[model samples]
Target: MSKQPQPAARAHNGETRPSYSERLWVPVWWWPIAVAVTMLLAAEIHMGAPGIRAWLPYLVLLPLPIWVLLWLSRLRVEVTTDADDGRELRIGRAHLPVEVISRAAVVPATAKSAALGRQLDPAAYVQHRPWVKPMIVVVLDDADDPTPYWLISTRHPDRVLAALGLGTASEPEHDKT
Candidate 1:
């Protein structure tokens, strides 16, 4: 079969950047809710405060929520090629070489619970996000590596599979024997 061209993004310099990157950001709706909740908490702390204590709480506590939300949304998933042209999948701080990826399957939203609960192996590497439903399960072939596979949470599973060159292996885990 002929090899298909990989999806790429244009770099800032207008160069063709070959990589797939996705950030697991918190939903936009959560921002206002977070700010509202933080304000309520700060208001409660401000009650009956003497002088600067009232306004001090607002100044200090307000940024706390924003900082926390930004921090929580920092998880990123990236697939990039190395100097040898081998692909690597980086999920958050963890990195997995595509060469060792024996099999990969997209776990649908319906089976996410079971995959994370019952079917999950204790030795497996899992990057889960409650905001994201669908996931990609990558089975490893490295004997030296004790980890069996990686359960990664991604909003675009199809694109992730395509980036990893596992587009044809997008079958669900339960479908296989």
Candidate 2:
């Protein structure tokens, strides 16, 4: 039996008014890496001192349990964009009200050069997942709260931004030089 709990809205929540919802997990790229690491550990254990090599299988498989737990826990995240009833953007446990959201934009590719150099306020909330690419930048209008924005990694950044009434990302100008 899997100890990791399932996403909400499937169980006792009973609320089914979400306009948009998506579940995101670690990207496909991580799978091979995980396997490679496991193999590497096994290889190392097999080549270790005779006494230590006796525990080869156990040592190599050790990270498996930890990997599974992490894969279930931190590597998976649910993104819920509820407009009709909740009027909020939900990513895992944290949520942002649609009303408080000022604006949203797809993080430009050039942002890599800047290394997250755009609109980084001191009191912002960031929910970053290493596996996800093309994160969305959401600005907040709530003056009461100190948080300036939310930088979240999502597979469907456009959809999430659109759920916040941000529409689509503007195409950047290309240089022809």
Candidate 3:
């Protein structure tokens, strides 16, 4: 699947635009499969049916799968500057202030299973997608907050780290030892 174009930041009247933005779209191959399945189901409903019954199923069922896929693809990840909080990482509906981020690292595809499995923290905030192999782990230092860290799936882990200003600055704890 071809990567979708990253959204370009535009400056308007000194407003701070998002430094990084990505929509976690489903794989391109999934679209055809979804359409085919919906069509097959519609065909089954249309079998020997006359007039509106045949057309109605197609009208109703056809858009249903497409709508579902589109809705699922709407999940977004963004890094933007906030007047009150400096920089903030936005994932879906949740936002994390950069100031609270104590450390960050890119979790390679090989370590992903372990990261999400045994090493996973129950108090962590995780936004995972199987289609996305790599992820960013951002450890939070806010003593008041119960969440330990954030495990977020991303196609471009390096870019996410850079956008968060953790690239080359924060290193994985395992590497120090």
- C-alpha RMSD between model 2 and the true structure: 6.1
lDDT (tens digit, per residue) of candidate 1 on 58-165: 999899889998999988888876545677787776777788989898888999999999999999989898999989999999988889989999999889989898
Tens-digit lDDT track of model 2 for 55-123: 767666867955774654453234344334545577666766677777888875557335355656666
Model 2 CA lDDT for position 82? 33
lDDT order, best first, reads 1, 3, 2
TM-score of 1: 0.84
**Model 2 TM-score (2 dp):** 0.68
Give the poorly placed runs of model 2, Cα more than 4 Å off.
1-7, 10-13, 48-56, 59-84, 112-119, 172-177
Which model scores highest in lDDT? 1
At residue 152, candidate 3 shows an lDDT of 95
Each model's lDDT comes to 0.83, 0.64, 0.83
Give the winner by TM-score: 2 or 3.
3
